[model samples]
Target: MNRKSRWAAGPYILWMIIFVIVPLVLIGVFAFTTDAPFDENSKRLTQEELAAIEEEYAETDEELPVTYKTVFTWDNILSVSQYLPVLFNSAWLALIATAICLIIGYPLAYFMSRFRASSQRLVQMLIMLPMWMNFLLRTYAWMTLLEKNGWINRIFGLIGVGPFEMINTQGAVVLGMVYNYLPFMILPLYSVMTKIENHTIEAAQDLGAGSIRVFTKVVIPLSMPGIASGITMVFVPAVSTFIISRMLGGGTNMLIGDLIDLQFLGNAYNPNLGAAISLVLMVFILLCMSITNQLDNGDEEMEGKML
Candidate 1:
């Protein structure tokens, strides 16, 4: 707000311009532009050719050509039909993964926050240690572990049990998502739970409230912000995830991320349609973020009221 603050913030402003603003502008431009002609030999317009085209357009144009449109024609929209299944599958799998993450991660985080201090540091280190390993290697490791005749089934065979199938299932997709994102859910929830003041719990007990009542009235309410953040962190990536789904699921599970990848790399060469699907996915991500923000701000307002 002041000159001193402006001076301090100048570097951050410049960094945002270079990193955040520039990438967004590029994505925005690409989202509007039609896919380029792949058949063209040179794969790029020459400077002189570009200048001639610009001159032709500028010289006799009755009205300016439409640069972009918010709403695309039905034909253009229909072109994105190939990605519908992928989009729906992504949404479903991510929702399931988010639920699983909360179910498992919440209890683990609560225990670590409540009982373990020195152990908590060690566990946190172990969780983050996976980051040191290559991500694709970790994912491939899951593939090995979950394949029909993989380690678990081999062990089962030794005990006279039949082979089991795990890989290439929806379950594997969820498992991969949960494994990759559990730490994200845990850390935020742990931070919030650990920061909770003990006096509030004591006050609830002093008023003869039971443990469940105290948790419901105090703990859950106080931890809402952390829970909201965890959901966002897990949900967004899980929904857009191609890496885990493609590796674990193979061709069986078609996720939105896989569709985008296919458009870019596989048989489908429709970049414009891919961009359309991407724009839709971006809208969905924004919707999730907006919901999280509202819940976060609402919790803050409620806390102020309590104070």
Candidate 2:
């Protein structure tokens, strides 16, 4: 690479080092280390009692007596088993939402790609309009709409269908995820579909292939990159989201993100466990993306072999 190109990449490399690498290093540090009381008596106290004692010490100016020993331990990582259920549930919901987004977005994307330039722009604008608003506000709107006495139930009442319990449920969480991330799926697929050669699809039709065959064999194969990208884009955020599950799922549907937040930022003062949870979540997300990438590559390999 030339000097100009190297210089251009310098800021990006610096940014990664400062933000990404530094945070990962901090998480590892916190995950693996814990403060053990140097005083034997302090170690014997319950966490609550210990906190009370610490508070008492803090209120007085006298150089708080005992120091804590920074000990390395596997307790934090081992404790993750207790949270496995929440983690698994988060993964399941994320997969459901991602699959729904793919099912809905693919058809919309294909149709959008077939439209004229002006019509295409209008559709793109509509798809992206929701995203221009605050994420929290969008979720709040859904929350209001799903309430028992909300506009949706009122409309249902008019139809004589009666009100239904829509808010604070697993279905609500999945709905929020799909609503928020559907555009991610559609845009990528649309971008890829627009680049697909009209001649290739025509060639399939010219061979005695029907519409279904042309779609399943030709168009779908060409759209694999978009499928992979969309899945990654939707799945990662959906799995880690606490707000959607908290607001829509009424905090009953606890996710990995919620657990981590509780440990770190909530009343619980356990950064160690939070960091470990964060590390595990990062691993799971990477594994998911890797599997997706492998599938995409396998598709490419199969296509190449056929060629």
Could you say which candidate leads in lDDT?
2
| Residue range 169-246, candidate 1, lDDT tens digits | 899999999988888898899889988867878999999999999988888888888899999989998999889988
Candidate 2 residue-wise lDDT, 138-229, digit = tens: 99999999999999999999999979999999999999999999999999999999998789999999998999999999999899999999
Candidate 2 to truth, TM: 0.90
Q: Which stretches of candidate 1 lie over 4 Å from their true place?
A: 1-19, 35-78, 304-307
Top TM-score hit: 2
lDDT of each: 0.80, 0.92
Question: In candidate 2, which residue ranges exceed 4 Å CA deviation?
Answer: 1-15, 40-65
Clash pairs of candidate 2? none
